[model samples]
Target: MYLSDKVLIVEGKTDKRRIEEVLVEPVQIICTFGTMGVSKLDEILEQLDGSEIYILSDADKEGRKIRKWFKKHLSESTHIYIDPKFGEVGRCPRDYLANLLMRHGFYVDTSLIMKGKFYDERAVGDTGYIQSYSL
Candidate 1:
């Protein structure tokens, strides 16, 4: 299988699908399925060798647990957060997701960014605290 140099670790298939929709560039997104077994992690680690990794987990208890796990196993991975109000990546608006990925240096579908401009602001509730990711 082909793997892009950029890898984004998410919580589940839904999260993967959500990200795939807005990403314009190639990024190998892998799902942890809400948790990971040691063997699964080892296999993922082997596949991720020398790749630039990013973790975009949900902002909740289970997601926090997954983030902690990645922190232990993949210390070099960058972390991306969705506002707590959204709680999960799959529920986050497409425009918001596009902009967030773009700010992290990932190329996103410009149409999605423009579409986000027309999205109802109350949905995301003034999310000015977007964290920056540096390469």
Candidate 2:
């Protein structure tokens, strides 16, 4: 129910903002800005008091790279990846992300769009959010 101890780590401001908009609990979000600098990430991780960490990045190659990076450095932290299946319908990380949360039983607002709305012709374009990442 309450995600007071669970933190969602993303890759940028837009991802963080979009995720916060849909979550019911107070989920702390951290952005790595393409590649998370070791010192910066270390500082952020140090501040965390053993909270569960969920990594939600774009369902693309770059996202996998970032996830891999985190896995190597934060192996002890509980980590879960946003499902890539949702990305097939809508490339916006938010769409797949919202669905991922829904699958995990997290309450997310779907009033503006219903289930499977991602398959709508209007929602077919890619967000290009993953292109900016180098990995």
Candidate 3:
């Protein structure tokens, strides 16, 4: 596959699949499977140089571990957090992911931007979408 300037690091295939549904631009998404290890890091490092990296994992213990590992090795990478309520990236509402990605300057499918029942209406600002539940 062609390499993309932007790379998204996710926890598993399910998470990768969810993000793929809304992506409008080319982004290489890599799955960590679960907890990160030296071997996995070695594989991921090859594609990281000169690319914009975005770390997005679940809101759970294993996810935090992976995030911490990435932070230590890839401090320059941007971290994208999903609200604890969503639990897992794969489980997060599509609209929520769409808005979050948009705020991060990533192109997403506009059709996935409709309001979700869990969104706080008050948070909708000039962007015309939920600001973000992510940190």
Which candidate number maximizes lDDT? 3
Worst 10 residues of 3 by lDDT: 115-124
User: Which stretches of model 1 miss by more than 4 angstroms?
Assistant: 1-3, 115-135
Tens digit of per-residue lDDT, candidate 3, span 25-123:
778999999979988898999977788899999999999999999999889999998899999999988889987877676777766777654334544
Q: Write the per-residue lDDT of candidate 2 for residues 27-108, one digit (tens) a residue.
A: 6877776676678778778857787777777677767787787789887654556457644212355655555565544445
Model 3 reaches what TM-score against the true structure?
0.83
Please provide TM-scores, in order, for all candidate models, with all chains considered together.
Answer: 0.80, 0.64, 0.83
Ranking of all candidate structures by their lDDT, best first:
3, 1, 2
Regions of candidate 3 where Cα sits further than 4 Å from its true position: 1-3, 115-135
Instruction: Assess the local accuracy of residue 55 in candidate 3 as a C-alpha lDDT between 0 and 100.
Output: 94
Clashes of each: 0, 0, 0
Clashing pairs in model 3, backbone N/Cα/C closer than 3 A:
none
Give the lowest summed-lDDT range of ten residues in model 1.
126-135
In model 2, how many backbone clashes occur? 0
Give the alpha carbon lDDT tens digit for every residue of 1-135 in model 1.
533588898999999999999886778888888887798799789878698899999999999988888899889889998889899999999888887887666766666754345343322325543332232
